[model samples]
Target: MSNIVLKRWKRTEGVVNESYTHSDGHHDQSTQLSEVTLTGHLGREAQSPIEMTKSAGEAASNGGDDSHLPNTLTEDNRNEGEAGGGVSPCCNWSWMVVLGATLLMCCILSAFRCMGMAEVVEVTVAWGEVDPTFVLLRCRQLLTNIISSCFGIIFSPFLLQLHTSSTTITIIYSVLQFMWNSSGLFVGPLVEEFNWRKVAMVSSFLSSCSFILSAFATSPWQLLLSFSILGGFCYGLMTSLSYLIIPHYFTRWRGVANACVVAGIGIGQMIGPILVEFLQKEYGYVGGTLLMGAVLFHACIGASLLRPIQNQTITNTSVQLVEPESRTSGVVTAEKKWTTVAIRIFLCVCRNIVTNFSVLKSRRAVIIAIGGLLTFNSWLNFIALIPFAVQAAGHPLQAASTCVIVSAVCNLVTCLAVSMLSDWSKFSMKGACMTSTAVIAASTFAFSVVTDIWWQKIIMGMWGCGVGSYMGIYGLTIAYYMGVHSLDATLGVTQLLIGLGFITIGPIIGVIRDASDSYTFSIWVLAGLAACSFILWIFMPNTTQHSHTTPLSPIT
Candidate 1:
């Protein structure tokens, strides 16, 4: 009888295990039997053994380790686990690190805007024997914008101290800017391939060296070599890396993240002039430049904090896996001559360009790019001319600097507020952008006609708001329509296109300043451009309904 009872029990256990496996796909017979035995202990729980078995199977399938399986088998714990595994919030520590570092970079770059060519031109005229002509000054400004916008500021106070002609300085500056901004194209691929921290380290070293070397330069060519070429290249590397890093740490609040990073420029603008002014007074330009080098070295710390996200997309994984194959194949064909290698590289670049052009096929993308080009051109033109306009109005250097300070402060506040609003509110990005463009146009026109310092301050604040609004919204707008994955390539293409405006507008403004002996005509022209940008935005599709609540997918 005892043997008969043991056989019956064994048969019953086999039936329960088979039923559990059939009901749930989890084939872990041991785990299911343990759960069934535990449920049987609670006499009432025996009635729901199947339900318990299903929950256990789910917990196991979800990749819960043996230790966590029992606790997370509950519905609430499973839901919590899912929420925790999703994209991290913006306020997390990792994101904070990215934000802090980006802000510092912005502050550093902002110094360039404050170190305006207008001030440099005045110093050249006052201290040097030969005054640089309007054309020469214009060329210098253009070159500065092109090569290293930051170095233009860093070296301007000292450029007049060199024994080179203004024309020579202009040429060197342009070469440097060209090297710096264009370097972004080359660095973008490396950044995508290797670790960004390595890029940041190299950039910091180059930038620091550029500043320290600039302090000892005595000729135009030397300045170009030290500050323009080397410094410009490094700056481009850092700039591209910064943009790429922010996207990795954010998705839901990307607009806010970008705004925070951009707001650092305002911080730098407000403080840079004061810092440089004080340093120049006590240490001279050479000593001040050396000090600037020390400050730039800290950027490496920020770069070091960047950790790669573990949840990489399948496309990224596949590319990484194929990289070794490509490298191995290249080694196998190492007998190829240099010319063949060069041709292959050129063809590869052409292919990439062709791939990137796919974005232009979309009407919405084209509209955004065009509007971005116009808005970017208008804002940069206004910034480049602000000090000149103020000085033209017969204001003191201090007053002009104060105008920059006020605008910078306003820009900082507006950038943060606008980004937050876009993330939280129901307002349409298109309408907001159009309204901001109109404000920019009107404020620029007002700046041209108004001479009173008080009114000029008001207009500068207004201009700052408009600029902040457009910049704050533009990135989010692109992400909304095209998706976040397209942002880097799209931005890169847009930058290249707008560079044409940068090269052409400065010369035109220079010609106008030379002909009219004032910035009135140039300011009006910029205002008109801003108005045109506003009109372009009007035709842009309304994206209010698809705001922050929607999940973004690649635009393929």
Candidate 2:
């Protein structure tokens, strides 16, 4: 004999709490907004809007079961129960995970922001002095370390000789950006093969080595090997890892947790310029690069703190392997059995790859991807070229650094503000994304036209706002269009596409500078590219109304 007690409760602040008491001496409680609770031994709580719909569908298919509640658990719910068991217990330690991830990201952003674009003007001048064969033009682009055009500025008389140098330098920067963005294509699979902690630690070590190697680079090609190829790949791995791990530990606080992790970039941006500037002043570029290498090594510590959690997919596979086979079945050969297992694993991987690609089937996701590709270089180009542009307009490097600092502050403030508002149903993340893109476009154009130091600073501040807003909402925007289940795959696929775009578009920007003898036109072209994304995003369909918070479910 069994009994079940169901109670309908009042809604409180848009959330409804339902409690179920079972004769098995267990209580099931769920907290959601405007959703009916299903009956089971231990009723599992649905975490997101998608899960809510799924729960409702499952309940309806079983005839609502209000009068005669089912005694047995469904296979799907049982599996969920097992998986949720591992994650639910780790929420207490989630904040610690955030702290560790924050440290890792802070190091990456500091090194990349400082070494990539912020210090490119000074570093380019220093590098050109060491290798006088290449013409030193005004440092044009520094995003991903675009440094050769800066050489032309120092040796304008040798502009004719800059074609090779500019192209080669652009290639180096392009490869770095390419690897950084495109690595996402396979990073998802790599994470699944080996947990996030191992991937992050190994990558962080490689990144440190890359930076140390950069300190001893004799020519552009050496920088290419150390900084562009190796460093970029490692950075990409950690970047994807940091974003992917947050959902594993967070459910209700997903938005805030993500914001905290991403805020590391803003914090790094603010610190990188000042730190690198001091290091550059005290020690030359070589010494600075070496010390920065040390600073980046700490990421290994942060990566180590990511405690491993149970993988439900792996658990399911283990269960199948141990299931007893019919004794009447003929014995299988060792070689044949191994081959069969390998084939099964390969097929499973292929299926996962296909599913990852399916996110593109959504028209809105495609638009977002295209928009990302078109404007991929906006932030990089704007930040990278500004210092060189400032110096071109007869301002000091200090003034340029000041502008970068101002932008960084604004970026941090705006990012935090947007993150705080993430749970607000009234706040439209898509609109914020579009508005930020437009602001970046306008600021890029204005900064290119106005050479006045004060005006440039003001323009930089505005650009910082746009940068902050975009960074704050980047992940949320992707999940918004593709759904939470597809977040990791979408990031991997979208970044892979944008990485390819850098390969083609990066060189063209360099050539434009070489041909026209100025970065103004390149800036204009970037602005136009940003505008293109803004226009495309305008057509994106509205998503179902819900708070844009990441659910606790593992991204499959």
Candidate 3:
């Protein structure tokens, strides 16, 4: 028979209590970091509105029984270590797994663009027909990607608070993979069907596969369609999920953990294309395809490792409602933590805008807007402009593709350095934003003047580095600002503008390069934007100083 008792708890006031079971007749003896078992809902203990604050955090961990209430095991009620073992091993893996998966997600995200926008430029130069209308194709692909991302994120809020197993995430991932597998056959049919979600899923899967087999497709259409479907849609959603997966499992170091999450996409961006390019040349497109699909399979299987503690949805059931400070007169505690968080986050951003009218009145919104603006440059230029950047520097097709490899590596290194340092030094997270903006501005300015191949590598890689760092901190910023509860919606609100930034500027990037006979002006325009980021950074408050005073144990 299973019994429930509070084994241990980290009361927010700052103390930890442990209850270890003394073996009687040889039952297992053990200690839990915090109450992983949720007997009821979260609100049961709220004595005041201030009780509305987030529960004391737990160990930064994942893998528990979602089938039951989270706090089933209490400190006073220690589980016997058990003969066959009751706890699952999946949740015990370090945060590094999430980081590795995220990096691949980033690479898959850019894979499609790398193929059509980046690779085609190379393909055409090497062998044959180039679309004079490449600019038009570039715009279409980018717009589709942005729109898909916007909608994909729209559904994310619901999923963010829900406890899904790696199994659930993997199933979704597999459906996405099917999309890619079908892309070669269903390209025209997909356009006709008009079911964007299915098409989007299929596309996302294919894009992930592309990273596994980067050099498989031989034609312009193959590269374009694969990227548009797989890289744009498939990779995009999976990357988004990387954010959701974290809060469900780990609460401590949420921001730092998120940095690694963001870093995943960065690493993927770094690795995806290089592997594809190498495999494609070494084996043929078929061999390249198989290799990439296999890598994606590995990632998909890894996603399966995540499981819901208690094995039940936290929401459908009830939580014990405490009289939270945010509550009115008499309120019962028994709501999902998410229900309250959603309300708190939306209000926070809106209130900050109202109370800090100075932040609102000035270009702070624009500075915030700049973050969205920068997101557009990564895949957009990689697809349309970087190839040109490569050609302009006088490299051959294969060698020019190496430029992306360089850009990827630099992005990974810089983001890791920035994130790890920020977490260790406890620097303000904004320090990262400032650092990225500074590097981007300096690099873009230098890129505008440099024409030598080696110089191009340095400058372009620097630009990519800035983008990667920003991506690394993307969710962490929201986590820091609105707290983890507002993460999805804040991302939603921020990304709408970000999507616009991509939509608005992608064409101009192409047009400027087309009209000027030189990329000098375009690089400068981006450089100026990067500088504006720095100016905005000046007005932003420092986050490193935020107090980390909560009791360091799992919420009982």
Best by lDDT: 2
Q: Is candidate 1 or candidate 3 better by lDDT?
A: 1
TM-score of every prediction relative to native: 0.69, 0.67, 0.54
Residue 493's C-alpha lDDT in candidate 3?
A: 42
Candidates sorted by lDDT, descending order? 2, 1, 3
* lDDT value, candidate 3, whole model: 0.43
Residue pairs in candidate 1 whose N, alpha carbon or C atoms collide under 3 angstroms: 146-177, 147-176, 147-177
lDDT of 3 at 508: 69
lDDT measured at residue 209 in model 1 versus the true structure, 0 to 100: 85
What is the total number of backbone clashes in candidate 2?
Answer: 11
Residue 175 Cα positional deviation in candidate 3, in Å, after optimal superposition: 19
Question: Which 10 successive residues of model 1 have the least lDDT summed?
Answer: 1-10
Query: Model 1: runs farther than 4 Å from truth?
Result: 1-97, 103-107, 110-154, 184-187, 277-287, 309-354, 391-398, 543-556
Measured over all alpha carbons after superposition, the RMSD of each candidate to the real structure, in angstroms, is 15.5, 11.5, 15.8
The better candidate by lDDT, 1 or 2, is 2
lDDT tens string, model 3, 111-139? Answer: 33223334354334443654323432232
Preferred candidate (lDDT higher): 2 or 3 = 2
Question: Candidate 1, residues 1-556: lDDT per residue as tens digits?
Answer: 0100000012243122212232234343422322223122211111111111222223224341222212111122112322223123212344654654575465346444444545556655655543323333332322111122543445555655554466776566566555555555544344432345566777877887887898898777887888678887777667656665554445445556666666665555556656666666688777877887777777767666554332212221122345765987776565454456556546644554445545555555577777776776776666667766777789976676677657756666777788767654354667788889999899989988889999999888898888777766665666555444445455556655565565666567667767887788888988998999888877765532221221111111
